[model samples]
Target: MTARALRRRAPEPTGSGRGWKEQTRRVSELCLLGIVATVLCLPVLTVGAVVATLSTVVAHWIDHDDLPPLRDMGAEFVRRLAPGAVASAAGGLATLVVVRQVQWLASGAVPGGSPVLVALLAAAAVLLTVVLLAVPRLAGGGTWRTAVTGGWHALLGRPAAGGAALGVTLVAGLLAVLLPGTVLLLPALLVLALHAVHRALVPGAP
Candidate 1:
């Protein structure tokens, strides 16, 4: 089959036997993917691409029942290495700036009600929302500029869906902190949530 055709093909519903076997196979596959994603994200710089690729894979699974091979996932990680590293660096820089600002505010260098503080917070929120949306867009393939722009538009166009994505992130974070053992399950859960959020908001998702 052509590459495009392969990309578009759906996964068969497990074996031709029992339904429970299919469920077991699906769960096992997701766990394997999550393990691969977790190990690949260890360097921090590849986090963005890892997430984007996982989001794309899960989105395809949810929307079309298509599951690409794990090798494809690794290939995507390598393919997106440059852009992903840039994105990771930008995110790290932004986090550092926010931390510095918070420290300044705590030290009383910046007044609590200062307009600058408000602006910073607003900018951070906007950036977070855009980043959340950008993953799915990047997974779909295109220039980072296009993904970011589309992400911003998606956030503006569907605030509810955007909020859902944020909620998913927050919930995953809380679970990780509250139940450290749950961290292993988080990768799959987060990907599923992202897929659901995008499927709900994107027209003709299925």
Candidate 2:
């Protein structure tokens, strides 16, 4: 299909009261097949394209009927993609470190012989946390360095809430797909369920 066809947002759904919910349902239904198809054929699509598409998906979930088409969103993502990407990569790295630390602490282990390891890890964590600041500015304007200071404050402001949300998302995303026997399809079902929840509250999200 053409890019336009591929990126078409779902029509406004039938409902009342919750404009955002209805919008979410509509977009979810609209993109369900395409998303499934893409996920199935993930090897065929470039990771960059998938990342761009997912960014559009995220934006769509946040904004409903008025959100721009996926094509335009993709183009927009291409224009200023570094900030969010860097933030995301850095965040992922941080998550890894946090997880590893938790594992270490849980193991009842003490400091290792590699004394420099702790220092290096601490420095990396500091840098990683700093990168989050640029994520907001990456949506439009802001220097990569400035994002560090701004992000530090935002991080402080929303620690608990962000932690809870991240915890839930990680759990749900992990359970989104399960494989038992030849195919149980439980994980995919879970993903759909999570998507349902996402659609309900997320604007224009699909």
Task: Give the winner by lDDT.
Answer: 1
Deviation from native of the Cα of residue 33 in model 2, angstroms:
9.6
lDDT of each: 0.76, 0.45
* Residue 173 local lDDT, model 2: 44
Please write out the lDDT profile of model 2 over residues 1-206, one tens digit for every residue. 78787568645444454588666765555355345434633443242233334434444434453445657755754554554456446556667876776567556574553454566566655554333222332222344456456545544664542333334445544654442331222323222333344334333323
Quote model 1's TM-score: 0.80
Give RMSD to native, each candidate: 8.1, 11.3
Clashes of 2: 7
Which digits, one per residue and each the tens of the lDDT, describe model 1 over residues 122-202? 788878877777667766665567877877888888888778888888899998999987777679668787767877885
lDDT over C-alpha atoms for residue 82 of model 2: 51
Off by over 4 Å in 2: 1-57, 81-151, 177-206
